[model samples]
Target: MDFDPPSNFSPELMMRDAAAYRPLFYDPNTTFYNGHDDQHPRRFNEEVTNDWYDFLDGKLTREQIAAFMLEGKKVAAIANSSSPKVKAFERFVRLAHQVDNYACTPINPWSYYNNPQSDTPQKTSEELVEEAIRDYRAETNAFLKNRYAFQALKALFYAGNRDAFERFFGEVEPNMPRNTLYYRALGYRAGFYIEVKDFCNANLLYAEVFNHVPAMRPVAATSLTLQDEKQWEQCLRAASPEQKTALWALLAFRTGDNDRAIRSIYQIRPKDPLLSLLVIRFINENEGRRWSLIGPPTKDADPKANHMKEIPRETFDLIRRIASEEKTENPFLWYAAAGYITSWSGDYDGANSLYDKAAGQMKAGNKEAADQLRLLRLVNALSRITEVKGDNVERLTEELRWLYKQNSYPGYGEGGMRYKTAIEQSATYLSTLYAKAGRPELAEMLDHSSEKIAQPGVVDKLIAVLENPRTPMEKLIVDMYPYTAEEFYFYKALQALHADQLIEAEALMKKAGKQGMTELYTNPFNDYILDPLDAHTRKHIKEAKVKYTPITLIQKMREGEAKIARGEEVYNNSLLVGNAFYNMSFYGTSDIWRVPLLNASIFELVPCYAQEMVMTSPAAKKYYRMALKAATTDEQRAKAVFLSIKCDRNDCYLGPIRGRALCDDQRYMNQSNSPNWLDRDGFGELMRYANTQYYRDVIRECGYFQLYVAKHKR
Candidate 1:
């Protein structure tokens, strides 16, 4: 995919003038391009005329150019060579990008060979099988020790020569060595068996490979082996110490035993790619978004219970400790993991350096490794750059966009397919960043570029709402991917309000209010009702208030209780006690001056309490006296008054009245189920007044408020 220059962005200047644009090189020192230090900058050699920038600018004609990510904070000798090996290394790097970015199988004619189609010619299955068998027989006799036996076998299997395959397999099955042909054939057969649901055969093939070459078990164990616990236990018993520990950690994680998973993962000494990936995902599940093949779980029902912004210090230290050790063949995994850990820990500089190291290692090694690492760095960088301050983040984001643009892997080849996906996701994320940075045009373009990219139906549309606001908001709710039905309704109501459809907005807001507990923090009536209402619209809003708001019901219930109660003073005293308890619990002292520190003041509090008690208490007492005027017995009057006080107390605790709105607000239960301001204060006010028999009875008896409590209790 290509980037079209937005009105604000200049492609020509970005290409020609280095000063006009921030360079994408991995810098090692603090050099401020726009008043913030560019992390891990790569220097352009004075002698080397064909730098990466020159290549991108089309000034350099060379097919390959040497690019360096400075090693640590020091300069390294540039390996300037154009040998075949160097060219191969360059292709490998591009291949890595292709594979990592476009992570899906390529659709090609070869894979479509089974289909009968003809501009030229098509062979029948029987004829293909006959040819394969003839080739196998001739080759076996002519070259008894042929290295291409697996290829012949694969062809025969593909052509439906099952009998021939069986015979050939019997001949080579017992003695096949642990090499490319053997493992490749084993993998193919295992996959075939799995496709056929022949678990028994698949298990045997996987076991043979695992037992013979444990280091290569990742290919086999990547599938769901844990479904059959007995077999998994056998595989576990046969694994090396490092592999065993990693497996244990993964198993523990899958089963929701985080403490054990952490303990087992810490036991792993050597670097393992699978383990690194698992650990990064595990950490992500805790800190950021949960990664799942099925996409993220519904926002409210998020699988991760321990949602936090930062991981434990020990977790970060362990990852860094491993990253700092001797570099392994798969050092990119450690580097990427360490980068993610630090990034999550708010150490963007450290993360940038670690990613630079990983990129450098990838440059030195194979493209396959580099590809995955590149995307890993991109994801971490995009997420972390948002948290970073200054103009540097913008510069970095632009550089990342350039990187994505320059690394386009074309064609429908396997590498290209995966690279396409990589670019799409990367571009989508970039669009979000652009949107946040007030570059909506660029964001829209990037989002459009990724329209062909397959994503979860819900999340994709949620993202679409941000990218394409011109599209009707109603069209974006293809099932409300990240939010609950009620949340969607609430969001939709807000959208309607923005569109000036006040009646529709009010109706939708009422609909949302009817679902679960209506949030108090952001009152739809006040906060979302942006414009002044006309008489007709005001009527709709009034109807909405009567339909959705719980204040009326609570007041009526209070009035009924007041008409039967004996002593209104007793309830007032109880309320005062509850207020005092809340004040002491929240402020940590009874000093009136300290109350202002609670983001409120005593000046407002005294009158608020006085007005609340004096005005209401008298009316309630009058109602109680009127209801009990005919009571000939003291017992009846006492019982009537007792019930009245309970009703008033219940209102104080759980009613959606003016003062206790925050206690039942649904915003606290937003996507991550993270705590809000009320949670921070220990929900002291609600806790002090709620949980009494009165409050419990009101919630249990009042059908309207039962679901509200269930949905928003936490």
Candidate 2:
């Protein structure tokens, strides 16, 4: 039931610093096609309109121009629009819409295979394609001509006229500017190669698109499929040197063989920006692989159980050598990565040397780089500690303080910097250290659990340390402890109250201040034990006429016990005391706030507290027996016997065999096949007063008692 929050092995601070290589490599999603940006189309439209605004000499606001294109308004509809640029755009819009009519309806695979019918008539599709081609040839403005050429090729490609599409691309590509639109046309050509089964050329052209256009990388990478080494060699031979390096980069990203790809790309071009992304990605993958080894220590946990894989020696040497050479575009990135890898491999001193080298090479004013190096240094420092002595604990005081401060940083997880993994790992490691150092109370404070603190002396030790912390280690323990001293006092008071230690419970509750004075909705001495699952009981408790705080409830029960001690109204006073204890048990409606660290709303109690809460209430049963011993009439005897039977039934159903059946529905099922209820202590006594009104009421209302009576009479 104890769970740590989601923590990243690769720091987002370092990965996001490679901003230029994003949306292609080192993207957070790392999917085959990085589609994290759903607003790409809207942003693309904005970019297009902004360019148009600049070209038109600010004839209209950018929003207005975008709106004009979005609305598809005709030129003649505009008032006082005599500008030549406006007229040219109007013609372009008409042709663009014509192209869209053909391009928008791609051949749906399901309909094409199932129906084999064209949605648009063949004659109409041919006419639209011809109109686009004619517009491209007649347009005189250079800007409009380029747009027309792209639209014409798009229309041909979508019309299924591949011969015309390829022929027209050849004619226009030589004259077209190498922009996003041109790269898109090349993507279409790549698709043609795919359809013709010329995969080598297809991959070659797709690599070009992937390298040139950042936004188009997803589509290009998705389409670039070199199935085998033969096709890969063919593409390599056909590609230019720059494209060949792009091919290796794409392969590295797709296959995660950064060692091979980095070497290949480095031999080709040492200053390539893509090399930095590959190095970061390689480090991140290895970091994820070795996360458990470097993470918080676990008691009795095998280091080889969860993660046993190791980084290959050759790969480590290659990265370390690359960092040593300092020929990469970002030497600091390489050094930091190599150093982190070295540190996790147990080379603390070597890792520190690499970290110092990285610090020297880090670019000034780069906060991300600075934080990354600091985090690495902290990792190295913590890894250097083999024991939890005073000196070892004091050595990390400032770093531990800095790590704690990151929890409140505005961009702890997603934006500014990521240190959550480091924080969790450090806390776990320190908890283990304190445990090994014979300070289990401090260990439980760092990595806390209700089960551990529920042990006999843990809470007292925690309180003792909080009251008088004498050493630096003890002070740090108090500083890092999550609960306030008052909260521990309240919890300890609740434990004492449950164990029938009234004097100790009262004194501890007094020390708990307002925390121990939380008001209860129902009277604790109510004769009938309310069921939490009953709708009427839930409503009645909310509107109860009487309420008592914990202090007042204990005082009331203490007064009843005092009267019994003085031998005044023994039966009545004893019954009232028994009722108060019963109302605070797990079977009672007012039981929610009775036990500390137990979630009363849940149907079953947690294992550590289940025995005390549900399986037994010796205090309630003991007082009920006193009431039975002092009863003067059959009615008083019947009432005491029936209440005592309620306790017996709870203990039988929730005891070892049945296992925590606290709810009425579960109790009914569990008791159906068993004769155990007939043997409970008070059942025979209740049958002795079968003629009493209390017994008659029990027979009418209680099915199990009614079954007992029928069996006995037969």
Report clash pairs, candidate 2. Answer: none
CA RMSD of each candidate after superposition = 24.5, 5.2
Can you tell me which runs of candidate 2 are displaced by over 4 Å? Answer: 1-12, 15-20, 23-46, 52-124, 293-308, 408-413, 471-477, 534-536, 542-547, 591-596, 603-616, 656-714
lDDT digits (tens) for residues 451-540 of candidate 1: 222122432344455334442222232222233444445545433433334456556656554432332221221211111123532332
Error of 1 at 13 (Å): 30
lDDT (Cα, tens digit) per residue for candidate 2, span 1-714: 012222333344555443435555443344631345444334357667877788778776776677767656533333357888876776677777666655554556577666778554332278878887888899887787888898888788777777998899988988899987898888888888898899888888888887787777767656778689988988889998788888888888777778898898888888787777788777655555455534333233665643434667888898899899999878888898888878867788898999999999988998878877898788778877777866878767777777777753332223455576677777787787887887778888778764556556777888888888877656766787777677778766766776778888778877876767877877777676334556754554553477787787887878888999999999999898888887777676556244444455543444343445544567888888899999999999999888888878876655543423332335435554443777565777788998899888788767788787787788
- Which of the numbered candidates is closest to the native, going by highest lDDT? 2
Candidate 1 C-alpha RMSD relative to the actual structure: 24.5
Best by TM-score: 2
